[model samples]
Target: MRYPANHVLGAQRNGVNHVSMNMGTVPPGGPVRGTNYPVYPDKLLDWYDSAGAGPMGMTSVRVMFTWEAVQAAANGPVPAPGANYANYWTDLVGVVTRCLARGMVVVLAPWQYNPASKNTDITYQGQPIQPAMFADFWAKLATAVNAATGNDQRVAFDLINEPHTDEESSLPGDIGISLDGWFTCAQAAITAIRSAGNANTVLVPGMTWTSAKAFTTNGSAAKWAALTDPLRNLGVTVHCYSGIDSPGSASPTVLPDACSALVQWARAAGAKVHVGEIAIDAGDNGFPPFGGTLALAQAQWANWQQFCLANDDVVIGWNWWGNSAAGWWNAGDSKHPQGHHWGLSLDDGATRTVYADLIAGSVRTPRLVLHDNLADPGTGENTTTSVAWESPDIWVRQWADGGVVAEPVQGGRSCTVYVRVTNRGTATWPATGTDVVTLHWAKASAGLSWPQPWGGADPALGGRIAADVPIPAPVAPGASTVLAIPWASPPNPLHYPDQDGHFCLLAAVTKAGQPWYDGFTGTNLNTNILRMSHVASRNIHVVPPGQNRFGSLVVENPHREPWRVALAFEPLDPWQQPLPSVQGRLVLRPPEHVLHRLRGMDNLTEAGPGRVALVEPGRGLQGLVLEPGERLAVPLEWEGEAAPALRAVAYDTETGPGTPTGGQTFVLGEVEGWTVEERAALV
Candidate 1:
């Protein structure tokens, strides 16, 4: 099985993105100091070896550099020993030599357009200029590198990283260039390289951040078609980011649409396409800053890899965006409170996440189709060869009295609706993480309108419930197992008509901790719902967890009655241990006639001795009256070594503690860091 001439799949070889990289005082910094954030070239190579990239069929490395780094002045003599560009040349050439030694194709990508950098300057010789000057700069550097390394055949050059139309006029210090100007400049650069006795491959890219959306709609086909490569060694590159279409919506479907179209356009233009930079925000990176689930991110990248493999002739390869700054992890900005995550391997260096694992899996298991469910087994159906966001086709089996049966019993009576699921796709159904069969309840609708996961639900019923029975250990390809939940219809009288009885029961395999809507296709959602025939009012209604500066908890109202209820909080450490006391420590001072205080903050009244007033309805005098569908909030202050769990309950002297409802058992603490203060700092 021979592949395309240069159709080798791989990743950005740089250990970290230059823009986010820690400079550590570059001019006077140590050789590899900045890259010490976690990795450098050697470390990255080690990761490749350990991750089995060679066996997985990956054969290239896209080395990134900046134009200014190589040729500070557009007309500066070829990169030499004592020039300002010396260290950059040395580092880049060392990477190329090392990659070539490993028999990997090297792609030299010099970025002339960078809006993220603090210094966004592109000049020629002594004056700021545009595309033509960029061509001159590349020509000089390409000539120098080729001469220095003997014009190695494995070497290729990516003209620029993610150029856009607006970039021409965005900068005031430089002359602007149109899209056609970029093509013309690229043509001149190629000619210069070939003219200087170098025939390395040249990679050209479309505008608009080199995006796929731009490739298809931004008159890219015409520009790409007009590009002239005398040596006939040319390729086009585009970036596919989920956020391109919507914020954090990178799914298995987005990339292929753009990739397929780009490949078609490239084939027409007598060139191949390479995904220059691809990234998606998996949920772990934090929602405010980045959206989407880790599973979706994995699926998107894997599908893109699969697409390249399926179309090896037209779509050459792709590179996971360069590793990001280590410091950014958990140092979330205004958008994401948990910090940022943009690296192949985490900052810790010890753990390579599912992203890396998926890349390796795609290489080793190229074109290994995995479907959630297939209509016909012998027919060998192939559904577009994309990643499975949600398994669509699940066979739901219902049984009665231990014998196999079809239809669930009707009428308002308690009956068993035993169910099990089978894996019909090419991919394995993971037993853990976000992949598991969960039971959810939704009001049944007329006709075939199944309930969407994000649709409305009664506040009485909490979030989707996990199966009472554990998912069978590793539901491999073509495997099936019973659900952990033993489905017993809620008990009711005959022909019950309330909302509870007029509902459908759903069993979905969702990415744990993420919304069910994350799946690419509806296949993961089995709409063959078990219709309910009974109705029963919830004795207690518990809402999802809410948080404050002190702690987090779930509130519940017992019986939905209009009676006022008094709530009490008894805080204990994670292990249910009492707060340790050091000779009645004075960590805080209470205002006169008040109970609790944290320095300049408002003072709080206590419920009693040793018990803080987390929630008081009327100056610690009256109870809160909660009506149906209404809830009350209790503010708590967590000042301890570990997160505390509170025994919280709405109380009524007539009903007693047993009758009152309890909040969520555990409350996570804000463990930012340790605090130590003087015992008597206040007068």
Candidate 2:
């Protein structure tokens, strides 16, 4: 099927904006799907039957073979024609014949990079091969393969893997070949192959590890394009790996700009485009930096497939770097022995991962998360004890200015609630009104119960501050959008003198067919917030410095049985710590003032001054109990100082408290004495 040049590949649903990918005229046949074969040909049938024949539905295979397998020596005294030569050549031919019989396109790639030799020259048995010798190897290999497969169009020859020069090497001590020298060998190989009367497709790769970005920018495009191909079936191949430029990044965001540039180069040069090697490490199983989540890694894989599908006109196909055999999965075809595992399956190919399903055309559902902190992965469960209430995802701003500032919710004044929703899934969430965010408010409490404490399902109960606020735009995969809901005249604590002026805010996102919970019954609030990404709460209060703020909160036992509870105070990090002057730079609070204390808890035995201080940061009060269906109103009196301060008051049911079930953060605003420049100098 052919698409028009201006055809739109993205569509919006229910007023949400979806990013459009401009598609040019699509090639006659859709792009072929494929994976790389192992260095040895023993597991060819096993891989072809599992991934290629089954749900993965791969239509091509890039067979990896070493130059030493075909030739015994570098220059002279090479093996005779059609000689097996250590049984490697015979095994490789059998592998190619089996692939062709299964109606699969076979791409032959030579694992020819020499690390010990200077200039990354093509080598045989750890010795650099001359340009003429390199050409002779391809000529003989092409002739033999053509004779075996009868010059089948389904067979293609990739010149070499990741040709690079000394200037292009990102590593030390290993000098690479000159670009001109590498091109001379490539041109010679092409000429020799055509002169041998083998008319199969020829695939040429660029320098700097054959990276797509380097192909266009590193002079590989013009040189490779200039090489003569009598059959006019030359294809340009490039490799793309996530975080290829930024080393050690677990889940770097992948974009289509490089792929688009590659397609443009191929179209302009009149060469077919193919991704010879491409794969991403699935960092889902407790991998460092990804935090054992599939959201980020899967999103990257989806982006890669989308790029290939959107540009099928110029891009002929892409071959994944591996199958799941243990030795080949991470070995990287003898080039880098310690390469990472980029396979789509695990457990010796018994377990098919998310990438396998994605290759079979499965679309992952949208996973929406409202992060509790910067370090919170969407799946982290109640792991943060003191900072649960200080979420970066939810904030309160002035209604008129829409300025995001650290301030309390002023009673009887207009304010806007800003909630950031991130989509971790591959599929975009439609802007349809069904995808809604609701904001609720309740009196600040240690243990908050749903319906009873949060004003039951009825709007008449007056718990909901904002209901059914639709996200203005569609959130694409790996994208975040902030929704603003204007709250006019929020509930005033002054009018209801019996209630404390402090309130807790809860924000939840609900969409049809997504996992959601209406209440936290069996589990604690923190655990629920951690497990469910769609919900988050804020119980932070901003108080002016140099003044005493009085408030009270209820400490209740939400469980059916009596429970012992412990409370403590902890200092916030420098970034989240409030400044003395909102305009001034932040400086670390003095160690003495780090314990921002709250007095007037007369019921607890350890309520006096200095006794109630946090015992060196995370340690707090212990050995207090509340019976089932009991609630205690604890009064708090805090005298604010002139210095900038921010602290969290956390309560937990465990003895040696870890991962607090509920908490409240207090932020102090600017004082009268400090100047902005003085604070800056101190910092």
Candidate 3:
């Protein structure tokens, strides 16, 4: 049963307008995901006081405490609430309470997964754990933390955000557990808090969403609905996904369908929703060719956010995911993050005016504009492009329980439909982004929303390519820009080079100051192509006999990116009967002077993904994450002596094991310094 469509939540839900993200870590360094303190407690509060609570506006804040830290030295007993854990929280809880004084809500997120089970896990020292214990343990932690943060309405528990679909989960732990599991788990803590007479509304997920839509479509919706009850005014949170939308591939929408089902279900059930996660990867990537010029997919995401604002009245609250530098989650303004320039605006005070406009009122936003890259348009070359914009004022982003602010006002010309142009861009500067908007584009809607394939369901959701689509010129910041887009033939796009049956053009936006919303859409999408650069390079050489009864060989990738390097060595001379050097540790050094020893079959512990790393590169080194435009050097040497006719094989992670971009195998064929023999036949 769904909650009443117009059910009203009290002041706790409506009055306070603040969002939070689990940033940084415990010791607070690596990833800002779980509990990284993005800034020192004092520094954080200071910034909140000064900067106005990040790009989403509102001055409220929240963070999680490491239960592991509290329970660290537990030996004789699990310790009492007034002991080690209690002391630290006494101070921690005070900080959150202060946010309330400043007109903010202190949302407490306690102990996410202990990472006990799973192929990839967050561990306790070196041991793995069983998941069943997660429930009871969390219950105890909540009990303790509730006391610290005040259960009498000062704080609310986010309650184990996205237990599934995080990086720690198998593929993406973004799916829903049954209502029973949800209830049982939540019941343990809810019952405890209520017993203590605490009124903090607990948070949970509906059917559970993927880091986008990776889960909703995973076939668990019916199962999810099978387990609902009446009195749980519980908040079901979710993370949606618009696959590949991060890269600006327009189409493949996942928003509408998921939101409709969630809203309708909530309306029927009488519960409230809180979107603890939502974001658009704000970057200048491609968009579908509607009129003359294509735009960035990020723009499309912004427009959808406008729709979200319109529906803010329905859900209780929302939280943009994150960004940060010293940490990695919430976009921060420090100087550490490498893979982190994902923030909506540069952390150096260069506010992204477009994105910053979202930081206001702390209410769900409405659509002020609409732009759809229209990724992977209908399988034909003919598509009509139209744009709609609302200059007056609009807003949206990560509505609660997968909902969207879908009310599109006919702002008229403000809603310009760029049907044909070879160019398009931002005003006052080439704001390299696109704002593609579509309501039920997800083959879903509250009335009759979309599922995975919206294009296959609704005709209005798609269009024919407009003639003379524009191609944007190189961007120059702070300058009014205009570019055209031309819609050429064979509409839509496929990820691979040339494949039949086109996918829809789709796009999503990850609010800069946040993490990519666990988002999704209901349609397949096609992305545009950038100028494909085809130039490439490689290097190979044979090493002659060397000291210590061995020889050496080296190979290199002179061009950018770690390339697919190949190496091969068969006996070049028929007279050399190369006896296989049983000791595979024989090594050869490359320009980097790293020695590469032949692997004795026993040395490799083969597993799924790839062979175990015997020479795993350190975190900040160019070991595994090979960079572009750089050469890699490795050395080779053997343990035993051999004839001058043994052949060697060379290959790398890039071009595969046999073929590099050079067209010619980097080291294919026989070597002149040793007897070339089959690896399988070696003694």
Candidate 4:
């Protein structure tokens, strides 16, 4: 059905309300009764100002108007014009006006209900009113509210309140309306509302007290499916409360799968739905007021909140039942015997209940965290080896910003950066959406500003470029996944001479191409940025030789482009013999059968134990090329004197014979292989 055109919280509107009494008051310290204390005019305005529009921050209020409060005589027919049947309707109109003034939507739910004195005989003009009369009442009421509020779109109407097959036992149990009859009344009311020139939305409820179960089980679907609102503004109002009848039932209905399925069905039907009332039971639901724990209440509340958020597309919002000290808020307090401890705030009026902050905090925002180290989800630890099986002695720092600088950039080359990410917020990460990890070319150490290095650089990168790797899995709170981000260094490095031939590579987890909402603010970005230069790193470590004196040579490439370095050694002992000659192989392999190559590399390999040779990666039979962030290790052994001293050379293939990195010398200790004395000591 056609609903109000301008409402927030995605058409359904999140809201709460005062009880089902248009005008009345229960004693401040009174006994527990069904009737809501009639709200005085001043108190009505106070409630709207304090709870409705103030701390509670709800978007709408359902004003419960009774037939008795409108008609002068219970047995009288329609009152004549200018007759003294009802007062100016000042209290009712005033509440609606104030709510609208505060930008709160209003629903007029007039029931043939009058329980102030516990009387349930619903009659007018000395005769029992028929089911059709309920529709007539809504027509007149909608007309009155339309004129009173200038036909505002924020106002809506409900034909009847909680109509069922049998009258509640606590009341008079005089008027029993079946589900079919209720549907007829609803349709009649919608027609009458339109006839009165009031175009406000209509809230149609199902049998069984208008609950999700009612809509799903008790023939509600049949009735709803048959009824049609010509205006197309009809909506379903469902009430949800855990364990309402049984005070100590073992199993309480919390987040029922039926409720979720119902919303999906409503969405398919293009209908709006509102959770008109929801609360946790004191005894059956294991909540307070019946010696239960607050944890139970929190769980119940959280489940409902998550359900609403998850289905926000079709479900409008919800409203807690009552907000007064003399109502549901009572929790057996002597000062307010009628309270139920379900109030979002305390009865003292100003004191906020434990739920005040919780209600506000229920609204969620996205939070993303980019880990500094290569997180191993399998082991829950940072890997000492390079990602993609590249290096080990690279010494990349974990849990610290600016991990070890990666290989430097060659003028123009494609690079792959691996970073682990986690969602640390309350919301779930959508598998594929506007949220993604982006690469940027940042300035030296100042990572704040991201100026486009060139035109067509950023906007060109779109649609799951990084998800190709095994890192696109959706993550929940406290869960992590990896991202293999790619970036191609500027092809013409000479064009930016002022850039000092060095810059930083930054990877950001962004939402809609911007810093995510509710994420770390101000310079504390959830991203991975590492400073890199056009240089390579090499190291030689001496080991206690087993078969003979031996040492290892390690080379680390820190640039986006691939590199090859030739290795040679200076003997520590003049009589030491050379070790075996070993051939080196390329590091990163291209995708099988893929014609394109990423980060092209040069050629170099060890000629002999102490010699150097040259070859091209992907071209020669035996040659070594280091991919960006790749590390290579080579071991050498020799029969030498008591102690052997040696110097290793690791020169870039492009640097001819010159030692770009200072060749360092390392001394190796004597080989102490399994000897008789050592074996005996071990034993």
The most accurate candidate by lDDT is: 2
Q: In terms of TM-score, how similar is model 2 to the real structure?
A: 0.44
Backbone atom clashes (below 3 Å) for every candidate: 16, 5, 196, 31
Ranking by lDDT: 2, 4, 1, 3
Question: Which scores better on lDDT, 2 or 4?
Answer: 2
> Which model, 3 or 4, shows the larger TM-score?
4
Residue-by-residue lDDT tens digits, candidate 4, 1-683:
22212433224356565553533322223211234433333444344444433444456777765555554433233321232222325556766888788767787775454343343233332234565676677777777778888988778776666656554335443454666667776778788888877778787877766766558678776677777766566778877654333333223335444377677667666566777776554332224345334555566566666566445545776666645434433532223433454555444344555545445544332234443222222211123212111111121221233333333334445555445556544445555423455544322211122223211253421112232233364677566565545544443335432222333334444423332121122221111111110001122233333434333344445456886655445443322222233233222222222112222323534444333333432232212466765544333344333434444544456654442322333334342221111111111
With candidate 3 superimposed using the best TM-score fit, by how many Å does residue 76's alpha carbon deviate from the native?
Answer: 10
lDDT (0 to 1) per candidate: 0.45, 0.56, 0.33, 0.46
TM-score per candidate, chains pooled: 0.46, 0.44, 0.40, 0.48
> Which candidate's TM-score is highest?
4
- Candidate 2, residues 1-683, lDDT tens digits: the string is 11111111011100000000101111122111122233333343444433433434345677766565456455433233332343445556777787667545677887654545432334455454468987887888888888777877677788877777656665555445667877888889898888878877788888887888668888888898778877565778788763433443354355365566777777555456777776554443322243323565567666665555444445666776555344434322222334453455543334455545434442223445676665555532435434556566677776646454545667768888878788754456554425678777766667665544555453322377777677765778777887877877577767653455667778877633222354234446665665555678877666655544434545667778887777664444355543333222212111222223233332222335433322233344555677896656554444223333344454555635655667666555552221111112111
lDDT of 1 by residue, 380-482 (tens): 2223211111122211123344433222234334445333454433345443312444555433221112233224354233234334233564656555554
Q: Which stretches of candidate 1 lie over 4 Å from their true place?
A: 1-41, 49-58, 80-84, 113-128, 167-176, 243-251, 286-290, 324-341, 347-349, 364-683
Where's the lowest-lDDT run of ten residues in candidate 4?
527-536
Compared with the true structure, what per-residue lDDT tens digits does model 3 show for residues 230-289? 434455555544422333234423343335565555545544555555543333321112
- In TM-score terms, candidate 3 sits at 0.40
